[model samples]
Target: MRVGPVGVLVRPRAGVAGLVVAVALLGVAGVAVFSGSLDIAPARVLAALAGDGTRVETLVVVDRRLARTLAAVLVGFALGCAGALTQSITRNPIASPDILGVTTGAGFFAVLLITHPALLPGGSAMLAAAAITGGLVTTGGILALSWRAGFDGLRLILVGISVNAIGMAGVSWLLLRTDIDQAAVAMRWLTGSLSGARMPDVLLLAPFVLAAGLACAYLARDLAALRLGRSVAPALGTAPGRTEALALLVAVVLASGATAVAGPVAFAAFVAPQAAMRLFGTAGPPPLAGGLTGALLILAADLTAQRLPAELPVGVVTAVVGAPFLLYLLHRHRRRTSV
Candidate 1:
């Protein structure tokens, strides 16, 4: 559709990709709902979902499985959207909460308070606040350190990797000094399991996820402008600096929300956006598609963890997939730069 003097092209690639991802997510979630310890049959599970089954079946499917599924979706979306924001700002495929120490910093603070809850008065909620604060502060420091060179993508990634290492070291050192039970709890949380997800947990996370995602969506236009080049943003009447700063902040908040709920489930942030950008044929990652892809990734990983013979955290399954992808990305980048 176009006027006499202009032309318009409409593409629904992302819309289609998102639909496929959504369908896959539903299928995986259905399997997850039916595969837990109780082993309810599919027909009974469907009846329970429809509110026609016995009380125990209803409690098993609707109460536990459904809530856990919702939590997985929310956490995955938050991390995936956050990844898109960071990558857009830096124009770097691997720039994510995981690589930037945002998640590690949040996880460190969370585990610190977890191991020493006597130091904090507000219970798990307080720990969540600490995690978010840690990510914010960590990102602020990284920005300051990397700002010296005008937000170079390589510099940001390199500095972030260093900080991430230190944060991980801190977490390890803390775990070493703590009691076994506290360490055990922290370890499980760090592994990113949906085992403990509850309806209240989903409720606690939804608002922050929605808020940060909306902020990212609002910045999308500005982000599109920045993609032309940092210098071009000013000529186009956009403040690249401010746009980037705010985007990073919002992204950290998003990642922190997920980390608070799911313990930084590694590489969903790193993997989802790159996958979405390639699959949707976007110049950059589309936040909404990236988020939907992430939700599917986590849900499917959770489903896989459920079917495993041994009890495994969802993060374990994610890392198994993500680590290889990360290596491939690094190898590709290395080859490109070398050329």
Candidate 2:
């Protein structure tokens, strides 16, 4: 597609790159399934996948590790899509689930509720619902705080930063006060590990991700219209107010559902869309490409975290990757302003 000043054909090149990324992601998933801190041969991995492996290998590869890998992919896709939606609606490059305080808020409630295991409902279903609620509530609060007769991107970012700081502080307090077992659970949630994900997490997140993804696709045309600015978009029949609200709601669902599954994964949301935009050389956030970018990043990061001797948290790994990218973005912004 010819987007903006660039008359680039997105079809031929983007398709091949996307396929390559997909294949690479599948290979990573296979690696996660077949290998752990200890490596497994490909033949044995295939046997384990085919259900012909020894009991120990089956339980180790197919049962535990694959589940975690799948969770990482799905969670990454959800958060990446959420980041795209938020950026499109806000017309801000830095908007993300973490920056908007949505994930932190969901994480706060999740940590609190999970602390009292008995207080949580019997399954991941209930946990997912509670987490989604937390995300929505926080997003709603940020929206309200940022609303001063009109939405301003700078104000929104500020409010989000403050809200996130407060939520994280609350999480820290909960962690410090809780018992060792509960604290351990809280720690995983904080660091964002997919270690013990079951099918329940997948089932809970998949439907929301699919639905919201479709919703984003439907709004893509409208979102493009909004790029013309406040006056032009409304004149063109894109109700700026309603569109912004819808976009925010969709973003909230995506972020919340993902957070429900894997805790608040850091940087995937921010970095994925940015990476996708650069890859595609597109003006607007590329939802499909962004999701794929996120899936690749998270899968690679999760695998690295698992393979590391220390077993570092996946979120930490993402932060390590994203911090430099963030600095680059700031540098670019400064250069642009100077020019």
Candidate 3:
């Protein structure tokens, strides 16, 4: 049943799951903060956070770890929201920005500029902008192709795959033509490391996530109805075409902004919403739970990456988990279709 004056949804299960995931994120952040050479007492960590502790504690808590933690949280939040929006609109379990070639699109242009710096005269932030531009461009092309293919949900995914292949081919071309050193640098970014995340990156990415997230919230009611089917959504007072348009736009913006900051970190967009769907037991991807799950996944992966002996890129860790998940989903779909 709905609650109170505004008639807000009262999903106890989802609310509790969101709370738990959020708490887990905070706990991971805490661990990341207090995990350096200096052994600041547990009780004093708060003091450091407040800028009242000794220099070492303050440096450890506020300066070093806080930025990284915020970066992961924001990037993960963006991807999660984008994925939730995508899955809801497509009404497909396996659909996501990563799966649909949005991340690949984002990464391609970023690498394009990286491999040829002479084409652009800007800093890392501009590189991030290039990635956003690439995602938008790729999305437009995919939508055009999907329209030609009858605007089917599965058809859109197929179109996305084709576009993604072209983008990957372009990336390969750029890498091959570049010097080994430059290609090495570009490949490192393609692998999606959070090692370079700083306060500046967090500051730049925050507003984009906030604005797009609010837009997603506004589209929630529309998406919920659209999930029933385009024909049925109209009976529920939803504009099917408009809702789909807005949802796709917001998803692209969210996913692109996150990729811009995190170097197209893979699978957070694909895996987070699926995990949240299971955790909250929702018929569809719940936005809030998905966002929380994304944040937790990224933060945990980053923490794990740091603790590892070789210090792998964050995307590498996620791909290790996500690849199998994708295969499983495909196998399940195959079985159902066969039946």
Per-model TM-score on C-alpha atoms: 0.91, 0.90, 0.92
Q: Between candidates 1 and 3, which one is better according to TM-score?
A: 3
- Separate clash counts for every candidate: 0, 0, 0
Q: Give the Cα lDDT of each candidate.
A: 0.87, 0.83, 0.85
Instruction: List the candidate numbers ranked by lDDT, top first.
Output: 1, 3, 2
- Cα error, residue 298 of model 3, in Å, equals 0.7
Say which candidate scores most in TM-score. 3
Alpha carbon deviation, residue 174, candidate 3 (Å): 0.9
The residue-by-residue lDDT of candidate 1 on 221-296, one tens digit each, is 7888899989898888889988988888888988987898889798899999988888878889777778888899
Question: Tens-digit lDDT track for model 3 on 83-170?
Answer: 9988888898777998799988999999989999988899888887898899999999889888952457788889988888888899
Q: What value does the lDDT take at residue 175 in candidate 1?
A: 97
TM-score result, candidate 2: 0.90
- What's the C-alpha lDDT at position 211 in model 1? 85
Model 2 off-target regions past 4 Å?
1-13, 37-44, 51-55
Q: Taking the tens digit of each residue's C-alpha lDDT, what string does model 2 give over 14-101?
A: 7777888799889988777866765677788788878998897777776677667888888888888888878877788898888989
The prediction achieving the highest lDDT against the true structure is 1
